[model samples]
Target chain A: MWDGRLLRVDAREQAMINEEHRPEIGESFPVHAYYSDNQKVRIHSRIHYHSYYELVLVCHGNCDLMVHYELNAMVAGDMAVLPDKSIHSSFCPPGEDTQVLVVQFMPDFVYNGTLDTVDSRYMAAFFNSLRMKRHALFQTGEDLAMLQDLIWKLLREYQEKRMGYTVYLRAYIGMIIAYLIRRLFRNEEELINYLRDYHRIEEAVSFIEKNHREAITLAMAANQANLTYNYFSTIFHKITGHTFTEYLNLIRVREFERIMLGGGNSVSEAATAAGFDNISNFNRVYRNLRKSSPTQVIQGLRVAKS
Target chain B: MWDGRLLRVDAREQAMINEEHRPEIGESFPVHAYYSDNQKVRIHSRIHYHSYYELVLVCHGNCDLMVHYELNAMVAGDMAVLPDKSIHSSFCPPGEDTQVLVVQFMPDFVYNGTLDTVDSRYMAAFFNSLRMKRHALFQTGEDLAMLQDLIWKLLREYQEKRMGYTVYLRAYIGMIIAYLIRRLFRNEEELINYLRDYHRIEEAVSFIEKNHREAITLAMAANQANLTYNYFSTIFHKITGHTFTEYLNLIRVREFERIMLGGGNSVSEAATAAGFDNISNFNRVYRNLRKSSPTQVIQGLRVAKS
Candidate 1:
């Protein structure tokens, strides 16, 4: 009689041995899809975020993607953009063979700009294009072709990979994003406004990403946004759903988790590298938010894998 | 008084504008680089390809990086990956306060499937403790720290970028490949095999990325290795070179060129998807022997950026 769950008993401690699950670091290796019998299966998996952004191409099937509780049904040829820190998950309809190519990254992937000022308009257009309630993921016929080419190129690379495939893979990624923007925003007024707003938010986001290392104050972030502290603070919470400080810390935690999961450094190193000036403070926050200590989490993952 | 080739034009037609450089059907982005300076002072600017792969990271400095090699080079840590066949031209190097991150990817970037077959020994050791031949390329410890973190996280996500970050910037192209293999390979014997034979030669390379398209010629490739047309051509190649047919495409053209300068359905698709079917007859053999074209060379790359 075998059920999915398995438990080990520890006699000495007289307790059931707890299992540790080191969630796969999505930021480290985010693309996860299984294709069987012509169907692609991807578990809902854990929710997460990163310094870089993400773009998803739904090649086939139907599913509901829960981005902060806004459930949207996704089908073939649809694409979506998940901005930084937007909690999200995706689930395919029963028996639906879903195949999705997910591209996730951060500002560094494009340019190494601080969060205060990232002027890559191509990226802005990409983020803005997703703002549309419903739009063709590939606007131009050429764009669709380019996207298909990229997927095939990726598959081929993954299949028969040569040296430096990564270099070209990144280039394909850039081409897809550039094509998406060009196809959707051709000298339109909405495009202009989209760029403007995107820049504003981008500047704010950059501020958070770069300054998250130091003791970034609300006033500093507000100033970067060119708004009064009160106005910016209230609006920031609304848009990002966390106070500026909270948002900054969350960003750090996400990054910290990414590095730590690779099992390269000690917990303290992860904390320090992720921009925690105070270990005690970091630990307290980690416990409060994650409901566990960093060590416990790491140890738990190792045990589970064993 | 310092006229050291400030700008170089590699465009096939001097009059051909930037927008006109769009790729033909199935081609990936062209490869080129540029150089420039601010205030019309004086500076040297250049961009080109070397080795098998290329890497760019912003260490320090500021300039705008136009969509098409147009005007500026943004701040430090703004990185880009250029495969062979890509054409990128830069404006100028950053000011005195600039820091840059640049690494040229060798053909190994995608060829060996070192990252794919984790059971191999060399791959295991490399991943367990990743190191570059030149430490200077690593820059400051901080830079290495950030770069490595960025690299591995980027590799982890190469299979899936749900957001658009990987699309445009194509950053983290290097680290993802490195980490993928490092995390998976466990057997010592497999690791040794990877280091010794995986990196060099054609057949070994080919077997690594073997399965690209159904059109590939199994018989011809088998003969190329001097094996009976059907005596486990793939398995024989692996015994000698540690490879397979699914692996051969990586060494030849299917995986290598497909993503490099836009291998889409264009020349590479024909080469990898079609060329493998007739190894002796295809241009890959000629190119392998002569170091020249199965496809048109990325046209218009001048030795100097004007």
Candidate 2:
């Protein structure tokens, strides 16, 4: 996968910020860990988005990385957070071995449990690309030192499968995320600056999530956004890439499937549980997106539970 | 964790069978994988039972294992299956580094997915201690060779983690399990002979599982076992180590909690959904087992989603 295009980066290209790039780590837990020296040739040159988050720590030699579309120098001991679904890539710097360690995991790794409860208002850093643009590299002396300690701790936890290592792994990763939030961003306001409508969108999205089980209309969402119906409809699509009704239906379908897997029986019951008063419409939307029937989905769940 | 008690095993111990010993992997999935050399000492010598399943493959050196309850020799290329909730232990035999690979995961890792759809009777090797006795180790020439190939493939998939490694890992493990069930068992009758009361006990258990939502009595259970009420009660307790009513309540509480987490709202609703006709009794049992109210669980799930 390597294109063998390592190059030097001056001041200008290093400052450019890439947008709409998201990367994925594939696995959700026990972060994907890799170490390489000469094998660094496989750090592909393709600039792409991953569906999960990634953490790259320089263990030996030096390198340059284009994270979120910005160039940054990574000497030995440098580290950076490639936020979930963010665009990033790595390259070997001229005349360097660039031995490094990579640890990546899916958003479900931290986005599922206690860390998610504090709300996005508190988790502004993880959702912000601006912060990722400015402080992409852990270059500050204390930040680098602290990060190295955490990285070694993670490597130790991964290397040694002691009792409750999963718990430790998550806790250590939580520490890393918490550290990034507290240390990387100057304050909460700056962290949320990437998206001017971030809070409004978050609140509107939260409202839709809370009421997806109820009879919701476009006007209701527009009012929740404190915008005129037309503007709200337009901006919601612009921000989320989905129409208001479409997004609501998506939420409902996801919840419907969750209910089915969680042991709710029957298509009608799951539909109602997922906030659908009309069975035919729910089935239509479900089939449209899933390309499968509700019965088939429930049967799959039954098979899973068998 | 090493007890410094390595020795040669006589032919007598090499032929013994261990019973009722369950080994736990703690984390369910995508599974806990570990590589060890001298680090094998960390596996401990407790000779204890675990709540989850485990797989141990000897990569280097020779050793003897206490699987279930019996001592057996494990050399290079030998692999042992530590069935869930079965008693087992390991010790490094004299000479060599005793390098090995360990893959451990919780019951839910396999029990919840498509693997369960085949019916536990056909997948009986996983649940049956009787079969555990007949074929704990893949020592036969063909079985050992096939297992080594699977183990190496697993190790490679785990180590390199090329694209879609998680999908590949699950598939490899499934293949391994399928191979065990197919290759290890001599024949259908041979497989059935390993378990004397497998069918009867399975039928009685299935009945309780199906009827745990109703007001099930000891007499009902005895009738399912085709034994007199008193005799059935005695054997049920003897086989399962729990009285019929106690086991029934356990099932009810577990199902009740499952329903609550599955999106059933309100304590009363979850209780009813779990098959509890009487509120006070269900509440008492739930509190004793969970040490928290159903409301707390719902709130926790909410936090998990947030």
Candidate 3:
């Protein structure tokens, strides 16, 4: 019953991607349409991960986010990408309302040949690497802006219907992934910088996973790594692209998924076991992070596993 | 693209659903799954509501299907209760094929809930309706056997769950919609009464949609319906409960969404002009049936008038 229990529970638990959530999966012709559902909550989800990749763009206002465990004060123009199975969560923070353009997709959206058959050696190399494949966090303002534009363009093409937009979408997905790899792994220093503290960060993550039921904090994680608070916070973000709080929450979401699948099929059972003291917060956070509600997730899990 | 192009696109498209292609409006979920190279096809869709409601039970299938468009289909025993607009889609269909337990919920799934939250009223109404809902077409001996077993226990607790039963599964779904409804709606006139002249069925459906697209089908539909030799040979199965192909695709898949704050967008211009060949299908079917495939429908069309 962690906050993302509604959305993440089903998606995370089943590991199905967005394509499966669409009506046009195998249809030959594409259609564009508008959607407005005032009855539907605008934000639903919790910090979680599925096997498919995720990209989120904030179209309006600012948000306080934890991406791949990094705590970030994100603005309208900011964006982030979480790779397959990487734990991540995001929200507008307390009392702060924001509009987010959520983009959930599978790696096939890029890797599919509908994009460009021309495989860039750089992209091939980047995808081939374990570290680069693990996760991605975009900090560059320009890249974010460009990504936003490309997304807009893709949406426009999808809506407008050009000659070969499907191919374009595949290419755009690839371009975005390629761009992320280029930004993250542009130099040896970047890779080295990310790896040096990765061991400690991972250790911190495992510790959180192993002991999330108890009270834990940045200091605790820092002490486990034998580092100072300020240094550890910076190093944690640098290495894992998330802060300790974000990481802890991701771990909790992961645990929530585990419990939901194994036992604790009910809301109360799953939430408490996931470590959320207040079910409402669990609901709200789950909605914001996973883009679905807990009732939905539990229901989804039951249906999926059934 | 084939005439069924409109049915093919997904969330990545930009054009409005109404304008793209309207040939495939009322196609139900659980379409045949096939692989192209390595990419798997997945379809997410809402609950089925043709002229009537339906219920389906999936028994021994190792497939992955999304229930009501949110839950996952992980194994054999899952069941689901899908309200209209609640989505569903094909999951990993079992490898060597599998058995299914399907039920169609009638108008009763809703009315039963309303007549009073009174459990007895719902039960009585559900049981009474089951006779009419039970299909005699499940001619296979094994299907009849499984259907009988499902009918007994499933009816006892269609509204409530047994201990440790997963609520959001297809089996559960079949229980509520198929078996319970069958037991309730059972009527003498319902079994083995009608045999149609199958020689002209497709032509009949085509004539109905093209001429009476503006009007709803009545007893007139069954009176003159016929099927060609080839169609009569296989068409009945397609129109059977598990799958229902329409005379005209009734809805447009909303592949993309856009929010317009200002004027200057054209709905009709966005529709037929966008790329759809059958403008009338886009207009009548999209608005009345699919509700939102046209670009203008998606943009809210106020911009178009402006």
Candidate 4:
């Protein structure tokens, strides 16, 4: 997946660059910026990884961003930080008229010495944002505008070569990371907390999705994550902002609602099918979580359809 | 002077750049900037010219700035705007630790369209400031600090490559020019007024300097610049902010004071040497301009010597 002629570099030079630093960036100037307007961006040959952080911002139109095994639809103003060694490609259909601005630079460009310093939060956040992005879609319109503005500023600084330009460029990159930290990961403490449980949380979420049709317990969920019961309960609240039982019930209720909306199943029938064997327990959990009883939700969906 | 390899480009490339656009700039990027800290910048091989305007601002230490036939000693915070085709070089003494920020770009980078419009005044004022600098040292400490701040901002914006960096750069360049115009040329109407007669005033001032020891008259000064009496008078007032006779007297009084300060001569003889043949007229002009009679100036010098 990493090997391809579409990325464009002399073979020996590419090898030297790979050994020395990264592709699309060199030791002379450890930053590379490009503004591309492509109607159709091919992905098969373009799937590759790099040693630098790649900021790909869609200026206009829609594209599908492929990161590892994930394919997510991305539209105008959507962006993603493809971290070092993350295989990613952006594909678009013909006549999509997608415009994307890509800026890739070495991590050390934003890192001023040690990451322990207070001034290094932006650099820390840069790494954290890339790692913590469960949803790569940058949701807020204003936040997207601000990020695009930062990219534009970076491009001008890179191209103009103004006085103290390197300083300006690095500083702006730092600001971009700070902006992402605010918009993406929330805050430093939360980001650190998220990073700690990222893998564990993913395991828990996937396990619940696959086993929703069968009986599931907190101990079973903890065993799936290879964690002890008490440890799993404590960490689940810290990571997902919900306890194992509550999260599991919320998932079951959501599935039950979807089944009821799909057609003629009674609330109790759908609730049992979604692994909620106790009808009274399901009704109580659904009313508490959804602020409405299962019957009311089904009636509301029917009213909308009618 | 134009024949030198120090300029660092092949002849064909130079011509093509001079024709195609400007170096350190392309059609895509119209502005370029650089911050330099060089202690010993040699001038012997550094004399060159370009198609774009270059603004060199000294951040620290001192250097000898050569712009055309004028050689001025520039100290820290001093700056010079080298307009297109201006023969210029900066020579520094070794180990002085001089730092400077340079911003260079095609003129059209500032020119948004019609030169005659008010929107283009900043560009015009920018070019005019380069020409109207009778004191290119930038003078006031406050003004120097302001310009330095602007340079720093430009350097930061240039390096950061933020979104709308081009817009920010172009706007900042316009602002730098605006600041200079206000501080250097005083006001807009006055700036426009100065620019109109800038060349003619320069010619008149030089004519008076060379012919000050002779009998100088308003008509002679006007004819030297190939202008009529009334027209020259009007232009002289607009350009120098002084009437032609008042300016000529001001110059004569200055030269007369210089001669008297040298000593060993009577006030009358010194005044005659400065081309004030009528001693009574010299006394009146000196009293009006210096607020002291020639005899009193000589007496003050003698008292200081004693």
TM-score of 4: 0.35
Question: Between candidates 1 and 4, which one is better according to DockQ?
Answer: 1
Poorest stretch of ten by lDDT in candidate 1 chain A: A1-10
Q: Which 10-residue window in model 2 chain B sums to the lowest lDDT?
A: B4-13
Identify the candidate with maximal TM-score. 4
Q: Per-prediction DockQ scores?
A: 0.07, 0.01, 0.01, 0.01
The superposed Cα distance between candidate 3 and the true structure at residue B261, in angstroms, equals 72
Alpha-carbon error at A138 in model 3, in Å?
Answer: 3.1
Q: Measure candidate 1: CA RMSD.
A: 21.7
How well is each residue in B108-223 modelled by candidate 1, as lDDT tens digits? Answer: 42234433432123333443223211111122334445564554444343434333333322334433444334333344455555454333324622543443455546565565
lDDT (10s digit) by residue, model 4, range A1-306: 222111211122222122333453754566877677775553222445567777778788767776643666878877877766565565776666888887887766555345243333344544644643422456547677877777887798678754334544555665566556556555556656655665676788679878977888888889999988898888878666568787788667667756765674777788898889888888788767656556666675455334
Model 3 DockQ class: incorrect
After TM-score superposition, what is the CA distance of residue A132 in candidate 1 from its true location, in Å? 13
Give the interface RMSD of each candidate: 10.4, 16.5, 21.9, 15.1
lDDT score, residue A291, model 3?
66
The prediction achieving the highest DockQ against the true structure is 1
- Model 2 chain A TM-score equals 0.49
Question: After best superposition, candidate 2 residue B192: deviation in angstroms?
Answer: 22
Per-residue lDDT value at B105 in model 3 = 36
